[model samples]
Target chain A: MAPAEIRNALASHPFLEGLPEKYLDLLSKLAFEVSFGQDEIIFREGDPSSLFYLILSGKVALEIASPGRHVIIQTLEAGDELGWSSLLENTSKQFRARCLEPVRALAFDGARVVALCEQDHEFGYHIMRRALGLVAERLRATRIQVLDVYSPKGVRAQ
Target chain B: MSTASHAAAPPARPVMEPVPVQIRSVVKETHDTFTLTVAPPPGDPVSAFEPGQFSMLYVFGVGELPISISGDPAVRESLTYTVRSVGQVTYQLVTRRPGDYIGIRGPFGTSWPLKEARGKSVLIVAGGIGLAPLRPAIYSILRHRGDYNRLVILYGSRSPRDLLYRKEFAAWGLLPDTQALCTVDYGGVSWRGYVGVVTTLFRHVRMQPQETVAMICGPEIMMRYAARELEARGLPPAQIYLSMERNMKCGAGFCGHCQLGPYFVCKHGPVFAYPEIKPYLDLYEL
Candidate 1:
């Protein structure tokens, strides 16, 4: 996708929508389209969180290793944003991301994006606020998942 | 298979009496949930139900449990209920053989937005056994496909093993303009599907929020989150509907057992516009 098309797409995403044009321009400079074939691992737990992703299409499974195998904790899809660990200082990957199908995403360099956030306090504040919202939402979702609200063992029928 | 187009009103006969019905079949849906197909006595008229209405199944001397109708509303030959063997009453009901007789009291409560949903895109979000209540609505929409635009189903279960209607979900996705996405809260080694809460599947849904009507059936917490997300994405609260649960006893309004605020969930609803019930959804121990 062309940079203009990518910018347009980002403009409509729930997370990025309403962001100023200047910030989108900055993001566009660093943004590039990346794709992964089905079953390919995008990032592994404990690996450096090198890039932030804005999923443009397809699904990405966020998984955690349990006793014997990896358990998918969450699935990210088009219009969803992930890899916020990229913006946090010294934070490595917390979950392994794998392509559930042919996946395409808008990838941003973590280091450069973090540097821009630090250099521009105003932009930094806006970005951090948005990321905070994402984090809060994810935290709520993760908390709900831990509750296992649907598990027969968790909630009994009334 | 079409029942009366609208069953939103109470039946003319006394609604509280338990009618004997024989179990026709019982199909295991998952490890814990099973679909029981029951037929009324050979000559007795089977009660027809709307999408979100529920039935009170009586297991002889054990007790009675409120279960949602999961089969096609159009099919009046038999009533199907997908029940999780979670409590004492359900356990007793599920153990009965095909020829066994059980008492049924209702096709009670309100239903999904069948009339208003016509010509609009429909989104059905179901979690676990919550899917059972919404299955009838899916059947209604597909049965009259031309009346609606797009049909989107977002279903999430605890795992692949817990997903209900696995084959039917695949078949629904093949229909024109219909999208069915399934996710699990957690996946095992052999599971290769999306892993997330039902809300995560919202990003994959294609709809004009203003033109789509959403029906949600899940845990109360899940419905709250899903409804909030839908509203955030521009759907009006009135356009989003949900099925609510309470400790229902009598299938009529006379019993206050299933009361929510001033409303009787048994009589006024199982299906309610999100805005109508949002205020009481968080009350303590109600």
Candidate 2:
């Protein structure tokens, strides 16, 4: 996917499904396309929270690693977003991402997007609101996994 | 061996409602915590609830916490929650009185192993204030004591005085085929009961690992270590279920404060089968 093709795909994504076609055209100028080979590492967990990517082709796995091990937390395929780190004010990602298969993605420059947001506050508002919603959903999922209430003490709850 | 007995067990219940509600009673159980009894605002009875489901209690100036439903589902007019004062929102809830206004959001998330545990023994292990989340299961099992086999509750706290519902535990034990056991990390001169760690208390009961459904809630270390012990005792991962907790804000699954891998404790579960969560158990602050 080229820059224009990547942006077109992103505009068609479920997240941006309801936006007007003109907005999609405006987005085309903001995206860049990149590709990765199978089993390639997309990003490490602690990498800088720089950019956001949308999948063009292939699959990516978001994984969490501890001592000598890693667990696949989520998988990304066509149209799914990667590098959601651009949303959080946090400096690094909480999970590492790897290409599960040969993949192509549309990348957006985080700084440039932030700049766009600063200039065009309306567009920035939509981006921030959508990004924040994603963050909220992910946070809820992480909480469930971390709080293991299913011990032998699986006693009743309030 | 007892498949015949399982067929006789009652069906499991679900917890979800769409009615508005208000606080009916707030009994100060501990110094900074209370057992909030919320009834349907004014008219209709509350929707049904299962053990392990939670509702978001919202205060005007403060926020909300996903407090588990602590009482029986048979009586659905009101729900109970034992909340401790840990943050600003909880402190507000703890300080409120009987008639004070508050918001109730859900009875969200999955229920415990009801039919799965039928005709099999139940071993409930809880630690600290974690015991609050497990209280409803205790009451539910005992409510239909004859439908199941043995019921054993193993609860632990920091100290003997820190135990919740002491008299109730004693009373639960007196019921046929039921027992209440407790322990602490350390003991004072007045402490005459088990003292070491909650995991050590697993030694006292005869847990038929295969047939028993182990429901546990406690700190991460306690659940991790306890699960190890139970597995060593012949309980496979499938036979175990764990309730997960995260910084839950919107019980309806909107907030990012609580996320564990791909599941939302506020939505998919606060209760998950051990095998389903075993992979991410060790992930830090995931």
Candidate 3:
């Protein structure tokens, strides 16, 4: 993708809404324009995570395996963020991320974003707030699954 | 979610019975444990409560739990409790600072029967941290010295250090009508108090079986046995009130986690008159 297109995409994300144009342009320059083949496994369960990516094209499937079932927890499309564990700590990918079709995403080393955020309090605040919201959403969704509201014995739904 | 554009308390309508409380101070009462003082929020009034009742405390990010009030009834502005950090949510609780908000949904459930114990002997039994819910009842009894008859409290702890409200037991015992008996499962070199289960303290308590009402709270195993001992001594099942703790997710009756038979502990109890719950609670896994 061209530099102008990269800048446009960054500006459109709700997380980067108030980021200055210069920083957005700089972020686009630093991002690696990465691509994947159709049906590619971007990362497997338990793999050490060090990079964060925002999809530029195509789709990615996030799934977790338990016993005989593989639950499709979520699907990520173009402009969606993935690989958040890299931002949290030295954590591994919690779920497997697979390419549904040929996909393109801008990937960045997690350390680079951490360093940038450390230097920019405004940017850091927005990113941390977004990260916490993301975590809360995941917690709520998993709780919904565990409670199994729709199951007959799980909850009466009253 | 910062407070600037936050939603109001989940109940929508204001909580009127028990005051909306805030954390005024957080004290570490034991290893990896804490005691919080919840004072009335700003202009809210203090809530009236009985000895055995409870309040639902909600912490953001973390979840909610049903905690019994454990402070003096006279000090209505701030309520205090010693809570062990046993789970993830409680771990978050100990870390909260003064002025941090906490949601209080109750003063729910039936309280210790001060009226019934007026003319007869009253035996208060507690095991482990189960004392948290029973302390307010103990304090209320002590506060109203002549309103009741003989006062005897038998409290059991895992060790010397775990006995809650260490400062108050002595002062309470000084009251003309009160007698506080504290025992532990195991005693250290410095431990001079009674050693053995709290039930052993019952052997020392002599009362007309039909004349006394015992409010008991503790581990399920201990409560069951305590009831057995009381029944052997001739106190009817109808006279023993046990504070039962189930995992309460939502304080409302909606959550099923606290279901024991058909009762929701969060709403219906966490406390019940003995006869009302004994039949179902005796059934397996109830």
Candidate 4:
């Protein structure tokens, strides 16, 4: 997709709303569309941070590899963003991202965005705020997951 | 407490009267859960019930426990209950044979909002064996498919092995306008499905928030979280209903074992709109 089209797509997502015009334009220019077939890996745990993605369609499962099993830690669907580690310094991908279906996303070159953020604190703060919001939400979800809050207690499997 | 007044009292609803039933069949649903089909004794009338109503099952030598009717309500010959052997009564109930007699007193409690849900989208969220009580409601909806628009079922279990009606979910998903999504708290190497709480499914479902009605049944904490999540997704509290679980001794209102503040869950409800019970939900000891 063209840069202008990419910008339009990003604008449709609520998190990308209210950004400075210059940063929006820069992100648009830097963003490119990416897609993966079912079961395809978008990124692997410990992989070098390269790009972050804003999901346009379908779902991505964030998982961890164990001794003999792949445990899905979370599932992200349309309008969800992933690979925030890419924009944070010295951090590698923490989880494996695999396509749960045919997924289309707007992929942004993370290093370039980080460079731009360093040059512009105001723009960087706005980006950080949004990233923090996503992080908090994920943390809350993880807490709920860890609790196994849905499991029945007293009578056993009610 | 006057003898004359006690004798003059009107007869209880037939649903509260214990009737004899014979275990017709028992299917082990998972490692610990068993689905028991009980047939009423010959010449006995097995009351037909709406979805979400429960019955008090009496294991003759053990005790009586309240269990939701898990079979299709339209089928009048027998009632089904999916029970997990968690206690003395439940263990004995599930271990009974095809010819053994057990007492059944109910078809009690309020039912799922089947009529109110017509012509609108319906969302059913169930956790663990909580799915059994909601099963009849799903049967009712699917039987009258034209009455509703979108039908979505979001279910969460401890594991793939713990999912109830595993074979039936696929068939339900095949029906027009119906969607079934299952998630497990944990999955093994062979399991390949979403892994998360039932609330996580809110984002994946497509519905006209204003025009949809949601019915949820699960552990108390799960319902609390799910109701909040649904409200956050724009579904009004009034449009979201819940089926509650409490220690129910008498299937009628006479026993206070199942009381929830002002409501007797056995009589006034097993199903209540979220707004009606929101205040009591989080109260300590409620």
Best-fitting candidate, scored by lDDT: 1
- Among the numbered candidates, top TM-score falls to 1
- Candidate 3 C-alpha lDDT tens digits along B17-76: 233467889987656557898776543433455566666677775777677777776676
Q: Write the per-residue lDDT of candidate 2 for residues A19-88, one digit (tens) a residue.
A: 5666666677878778899878878888888878878778676777756667555555775677877755
The DockQ figures for the candidates are 0.58, 0.02, 0.01, 0.46
Candidate scoring better on lDDT of 1 and 2:
1
Which ranges in model 1 have alpha carbons more than 4 Å from their true place? Answer: A1-25, A28-35, A56-58, A102-106, A153-158, B1-7, B12-14, B42-46
How well is each residue in A1-158 modelled by candidate 1, as lDDT tens digits?
A: 99899888778878787889899888888889999999889999999888999898887888899887888788787878879999887889998888888899888888898899989988888889999999998898889888888976655473
Evaluated at residue A17, the lDDT of candidate 4 is 80
Residues B264-285, candidate 4, lDDT per residue (tens digit)? 8887777888888899999857
All-Cα superposition RMSD per candidate:
3.5, 20.9, 25.8, 4.9
Task: Give the count of colliding residue pairs in each prediction.
Answer: 2, 42, 1, 0
| Tens digits of lDDT, candidate 4, A33-74 | 999998899999999988989999987888898987788777
In order, candidate lDDTs are 0.85, 0.70, 0.69, 0.83
Supply candidate 3's per-residue lDDT for B196: 49
Candidate 2: segments with Cα more than 4 A from true spot: A1-158, B1-20, B42-46
Q: Name model 3 segments beyond 4 Å from true.
A: A1-158, B1-21, B42-46, B284-286
1 or 2, greater by TM-score: 1
Q: What is the C-alpha lDDT profile of model 1 across B144-191, one tens digit per residue?
A: 999999999999888898999999999999989999999888887467
Against the correct fold, how does model 1 do in TM-score?
Answer: 0.90
